[model samples]
Target: MAEAAALSRPAGVVGRRTWANGLFVLPFFLTFLALMVLPLGVGMWLSFQDYDMLGGYGGSVGFENFTRLWEDKIFLRSVLNTVYFVCLSTPAFVALGLFLAISLNDTYRRSAVLRSIFFGSSVLSVTIVTLIWRLVYMPERGLLAVSAGAVGLSSPSFMTTESLAMPGIAIVTVWWIIGLPMMLFLAALQQIPREVYEAAALDNASRWTTLTRITLPSIRRTIVLVAVIEVILQFQIFGQVHLITNGGPNNATRPIVMFIYEAGFRDWSLGYAAAASQVLFVLMLAASFFQIWIGRSKQED
Candidate 1:
């Protein structure tokens, strides 16, 4: 009877511990369900139905909204513009970030100050960044214009020209987002074993060879991560264009997210907007998978 009671006591303690662990994790699970899962499920449902704020939910239209999107010239244009922005901005962000990270890693004096200066812009709110750039890009009265005028040249309107609008936004995005990848690369660089570099030095390996073989391979994973993250972030770009250009210059700068926002709220086409969002989501997911596959293939090679 005494041995049986002792065994039962252990079981009770185990049960209590299991309960305590569940209790500790319960809030996070509940929050995730309420905030992420629930909204995503509802959004999926709304994409299939004819949902309008004023008209209320109507009969299911199946893929009618999606079909219309394919034929929508404006929507298609926005999609193309978004792709263009992602392509133009992502490479610049990743390359510049890696370059800066490598340079800073080699620097021994005031490295922290330089890192902070580069990363300080990223910590600012999106609204603040947009407003600050708005002033910087404003023609005649803006800093760029003022500097150009002092040199006996006029500054072209950065936000208004069709050719320059998207690139202008891309530049701002790169400046704003470069710090994250830089810091990520810096961390990855620090993790690399110094003995490998010492051996390379003993072998008299050229700088280019060392970079291509040693440094890059060591930080390949971090490079993939930064590239994937940049692609995802740039693909969904809207805030800067919305606040700065308002997708002007004949919608040349408009992106998919901005179009979806306009459709859902401004035009009151919730179902159509939801369909567009789902399409964007799918594109981003595909891009991410493709990048991961490419990275894995390179690693294997």
Candidate 2:
């Protein structure tokens, strides 16, 4: 009888402990299920339905949304614009950030000030960044124009010209985002062993040779990590495009996110916008997987 009682006591204790642990994690798990999993599931369902007040949810149309999107000229244009922006902004930001990080990593004095200046870009809200750059890119009333006039040159309308608008947006994006990678790269640079450089110099390696052979190889992992992050972030660019261009100048600067917003909110086509969002999600997932594969391939080599 005593043996059975002892076993029961332990079993009850174990059950209680398990419940206690579950109680601690239950809130977070429930929150994730509600906020992320549930929304994603509903969004996926809505993507296929064609939900609109006029057209209404015409039920599951079997990939009609996907097909319709492919046939959409504006959608296609937006995708291309997004691709261009990502291609331009990601590389520029990553390269410039790495260069700045490498330069500042060795500086002893004023390093804090330089670091702050670079990092300060990331702290600015999207509205502030967009407003600031809008003024700079303005035709006659802007800094660029004023500078051109000072130099006895005619001012060009950067934002109004389709040729210059996308690039101008990209420049602002690069300036704002370079800060993140710069700080990350700076951290990575600090972790590199100083002895490695000294040894390279002892072997009579020139600065250029040392940089190419030593510094670069040592920082390859950091570069790859930052590059992947930059690519992902650039692909989803919305704020700058919306605030500055509103995807204007003949849809030249329209990105996928802005397109989705316009479709859902502006046009009141929630289902179509949801479809566009799913496409964007898939594209981003594929790009992320590709980056991971490249990183792994580099490691194997």
Candidate 3:
């Protein structure tokens, strides 16, 4: 009976400890469920309902909202615009960011001032970045015009022109956000062992050879990470496009987010807006899964 009692005591104590641990985690779990999970669920619910009015949710319309997305011409154009911007911006962000990080990362020759000059624009608010670029992109009085005049070249207004507008926004976005990817790549560069470079130097490796064989291979994951992050970020571009072009000249720069905004707020098509948001959510999810697949594949290889 004593042995059975001893065993029972430990079981009781273990159960109490487990309960205490759960109690400690309960607040966090509840907060996450309330804040993140609840909103997501509500948004998903809202997407299916004809909830046009601000606080008035109507009956479920099933997949009507999703079906309309394919039929909506503006939404289709916005999706294409978003894809164009992503293609233009993602490579520039990844490549230029890596270049900046590598160039400024030399321990012997690195200058703080140079680093700050390159990275400073990134921390500025979106409005400030747009305003600054607006000045640079100004028709005749801007820096680009002034410089081009000095070089005997024509500087057209990129913001107003249909063909140039999206590309121009892409350039500004790269300047504004390149620092994030640069810093990320810089951190990854720092993690590469100094011994790797030293060994390459001992082997009489050229700069290009060392970079190709040693530097890039070592930070392959980081390059992939930066590319995926840039793709995700550029996909949701709204602020720069809105401020600079207002998706204008022909709605050429209108991104999916801007379309969703105009639908939800401007047109009062809440369900349609929510459906567009869901599509965006799905695209980002797909990109995330791709990143995971790449990581797993690299590990296996």
Candidate 4:
């Protein structure tokens, strides 16, 4: 009777454990299906059909939207503009973040304050950020113009100028995002053991040599991670350009996301918009893979 009781207890415990694990995982699986899988599947299906809200779904056109996208000049321009923004902003984000992290890694009282100041901007919503910068870039009356006037110089119209508009937006993006990478780098820096630095000091290593040999090599993985993340995020840039420029000054700052919005909601071309979104998704996936390949190669070397 005692042996039978012990066997029965084990079966009951296993049944309870299974149910507990399933309960914990069920919410995540449901959320993922609702949010990600369902939307993606719907979008892909819509892309092949002539989907119009007023007229309802037309018969499948078989890549007609994609072909049209190839010939659409404005859409092509938006893609180029997105690439340009990514190119302009990514390096600045990575370099400045790394610089700040290295400079502020000390335990000094002022370092903590400085770190907070740099990172505080990131916590603000994109709407708040754009509004603040809008006032800063306002012509003649904005803070930037007023400051320039005080110094006997004229302020450039940031949003109105075609040549400077995208780059100007890039600057704002870099400022907003630099904090994330900076904190990541700081964490990576802290993970480096103190004994390694002590050994370098004992060997009479110069500051530059120590940095080049010890510090950088130790954080190589973090650098690659930051670079890839920055690239992916910058490629989707829309909020700043949307709020500040509205793709103005002759659509000079229009990125792919804005184009997608225009096609879908404004123009009522859901099929075409879906196609454009797929293109952007493919581009991002390719870029991510390329970065991962480079990271793996470096690690192997």
Candidate 5:
């Protein structure tokens, strides 16, 4: 009887633990369904039909939205712009972040301050960052223009010219977001065992060799994570352009997300917006899968 009672007590403890876990998990799960899963399912369905703010799905239009996107001029331009932004900004952030991370990993007093200054930028409200840069990018009285004039060079409109506008936006975005990956890489760098570096140094590995061989190889997972995250976030860039450029200077700064916003709100073309979003969604999914595949292959190697 005592053995049976002991078995029952173990089962009761297991049941209590399961209940506690479920209780702790329920809020997050419910929030995810409400905010993410449900909306995604609805958006996928809406992409197949004509959905507007005024009404629900306005009957099935088959692939008309998808088909129309292929022929959309603005949408095409937005796609190009987004591709350019991602290509240009992703590398800058990843490289700069990694460099700063490696440089700061040794942990001096100045390094702490520098890390705070760099990572502090990431915590700023995007609106505040956009507004500040908007002032800085001002053609005539802006700091950049004033600096250029001081240097005896002709000051050009950074935000007004097609050639320079997107690059200008890219620079601001990089400054704003580069810190996140930088901090991540810094943490990953700290996790590396001091013994590994010591051993490498004993073998006469140069600083460059140590970094490339020991530091990088150890932080491979973190690198992949930061790269994938930056790709996803920067690919959907909208707030900066919306505040600073508004996809202006001949739509040179128009990202895919900005395109969706303009179509839905500015153009009042909800169906077209939904269609464009579907395309962006597909592109993001493909990129994510490709990253995962590459990561898996690298692991195998």
Candidate 6:
């Protein structure tokens, strides 16, 4: 009886621990289901329905909404513009973040003040960021204009120029988001064993070799993570453009998210907006998987 009690005690403890773990996770699971899963499911359903602001669900439209997207010149342009922004912004996000992380990861340079300065902008609201940058981009009187005047150059209105508008927004976004990747890389850099660098130094490994071989390889997964996150984020860019250019100067700066917002709220075409949203979801999903595959392939190589 004593042996049986001892055996049963372990099983009872395991059961209680399992229940405790489930209880701990229950809140997050419920929140996710309520917030993420339900919205996504509803969006998918709405994509198939002929929904609107006034009439609500006006019955199913089948694939007409999705199929019509191909014929949408504005939608196609928005998609292209979004891709352009992603291409413009992602490299800077990854490279600049890595550069800043590597530069500041050292013992002597790991200054809290400096990190905070770089990271400070990211915590600001998008509206604030746009407002601040609006002053910087304001023609003939703003910081850039003043500086350009000082240099005997003219600073044209960036927000009005089709060629420069998206780039201007991209620059602002980079300033806002670069800090996160830097922090992520910094954390990953710290995780690398000190002994590895010490051995590299002892073996007469040059700085370039140390970075290319040891530093990057050690943080490859973090690199992929930062890249993927930036790609997904930049692809969905809307707030900056909405506040800055309002997708003006020939729709050169409009993005897919902005299109969805306008289509749903502005035009009251909720079904069409939901279809566009799903397309975006699929694009983001595909891009993430492709990046993960590429990262894994390189890691394997």
- Candidate 6, 1-301: lDDT as tens digits: 9888767787879788889989989999999999999999999999998988987768999999999998999999999898899889998999999999988887664576778889998899999999999999998888999999998998977888999998898899999878899999999999999999999999999999999999999999999999899988888899999999999889999999999999999999999999999999998899889989999999899
lDDT of 3 by residue, 80-129 (tens): 89888888988898889889889889765445567778888888999999
Could you tell me which residue pairs clash in candidate 3?
A: none
Q: Which candidate achieves the best TM-score against the true structure?
A: 6
Cα displacement (Å) at residue 164, model 6: 1.5
| lDDT agreement of model 1 with the native | 0.91
Model 3, global lDDT: 0.88
Off by over 4 Å in 6: 1-21
User: By the lDDT metric, which is better: model 4 or model 5?
Assistant: 4
Off by over 4 Å in 4: 1-23
Better of 4 and 6 by TM-score: 6
User: After superposition on all CA atoms, how large is the RMSD of candidate 5?
Assistant: 2.8
Quality of model 5 by C-alpha lDDT? 0.86
Measured with C-alpha atoms, the lDDT of residue 275 in candidate 5 is 78
- lDDT by residue for model 5 over 48-146, one digit each (tens)? 878776665578898998888888888899999998998888889889999999888775899999998999889999899998998899987998889
lDDT of 4 at 148: 99
lDDT over C-alpha atoms for residue 137 of model 1: 97
Candidates 2 and 5 compared: the better one by TM-score is 5
Candidate 5 residue-pair clash tally:
0
RMSD of 4: 3.4
Which digits, one per residue and each the tens of the lDDT, describe model 1 over residues 14-115? Answer: 799889989989999999999999988888888888888888888899999999999999999999999999999888977998999988996666888899
lDDT, residue 33, model 2: 100
Residue 271 lDDT, candidate 6, scale 0-100? 95
Would you list the clashing residue pairs of candidate 2?
Answer: none
